[model samples]
Target chain A: AQSVSQHNHHVILSEAASLELGCNYSYGGTVNLFWYVQYPGQHLQLLLKYFSGDPLVKGIKGFEAEFIKSKFSFNLRKPSVQWSDTAEYFCAVRSFMNRDDKIIFGKGTRLHILP
Target chain B: GAGVSQSPSNKVTEKGKDVELRCDPISGHTALYWYRQSLGQGLEFLIYFQGNSAPDKSGLPSDRFSAERTGGSVSTLTIQRTQQEDSAVYLCASSTRLGGLFFGEGSRLTVL
Candidate 1:
């Protein structure tokens, strides 16, 4: 079993501001990490994911995340955020035990981007 | 030209009633998942189906909740004797190999 923890419940940022959301997981074995975004009135969409390669991964809309294995963290970051970035972000983890392991999701961070 | 699709975008049922939500996964996805999203809450895993077998039902909150996938494509989530607490957005997602999920618009269930 795996679990994910998001440090921030809500975040507010002005336009063009740099944003970073903290995410941590509690899995000792190999795992797959993902960040999903759900915009207002929209379904959950995958932003990015890390399976077994580089720690740094880039996603749609200029978003990125760094997988720090030592810290058990995979934090989402963006150099500059726009008003359209307002959405709820979730961090998820899937252990490598079974090919179809269940993904554990965090409580999600509601991001409000003000112009 | 296809993605996951769920039926009855909104479902309203009385307490203690039975409700069934449907999901049509992507054409070739081998994995399907069901999740519940409460107002201002995170997505809670309900059940998972890989192909035709479900290895984990631990995410189901109670025995009243059950789900099944047939032909490894379409899925149905049935909640028996539903409660008011079940009022939330029931989401369905499908993945080609459990890496990235393509989600449906979701079926919003309101237990009144």
Candidate 2:
């Protein structure tokens, strides 16, 4: 079974600090990577996705992730975080085998930005 | 209506009782999915429905859990004789053939 791992369980940082969340997956085939953000009292929304081509993918809210195939990692990063950025971030992956679109999500990382 | 819609945003039921969670996927979506998100845990895939084909229920945790999609649209996930361990947020998502999933607010189920 394929799985995703998020290194950070809970992260607390002051506003304007840099943010980097680590994510790694266990799969050998071609996969689609994604980052989903769940704001307080909101649904899970797509932040970014990597299908093919460029390894570096930029998403909304100034978030970007790099897909390192060698490491089986797709880490999300933000240059400067804001107080509003406090939320739970999830890293997910979907394999292309047989065109099965079942997506697997990592145990999210809870981020709290203090003002 | 607009995005995926899940009914009963929060549901609290006694252990051993049955509970049903509803999901209304986006219009014209061909793929619907069910996932469970427990506290401090990652999203657990429950089932997947694509078009009129048989659903992929491989992810369902146990025989107590089952789901169905009607008319290729709305879906219902029913947990029979729910246990306390079944407490989690049940999320429904829909997508186009090759599009990113659009999720609902999710239905929080608390079994006590």
* TM-score values for chain B across all models: 0.95, 0.98
- Candidate 2: give the clashing pairs: none
Q: All models: lDDT?
A: 0.91, 0.94
Q: Candidate 1, residues B1-112: lDDT per residue as tens digits?
A: 2999998899999999999999999898888889999966799999888875644688899999998888787899999999999999999998877658889999999999
lDDT by residue (A1-115, candidate 1, tens digit) is 6779999999999999999999999886788899999999999999999998889999999999999989999999999999999999999999876554778799999999999
CA error at residue A71 for candidate 1, angstroms:
0.2
Instruction: Report the Cα lDDT for residue A53, model 1.
Output: 85
TM-score of chain A, every prediction, order shown? 0.95, 0.96
**Candidate 2 lDDT by residue in tens digits, B71-95:** 9999999999999999999999999
**Residue B13, model 2, lDDT:** 98
Give the fraction of reference interface contacts each candidate recovers. Answer: 0.91, 0.88
* Worst ten in a row by lDDT for model 1 chain A: A95-104
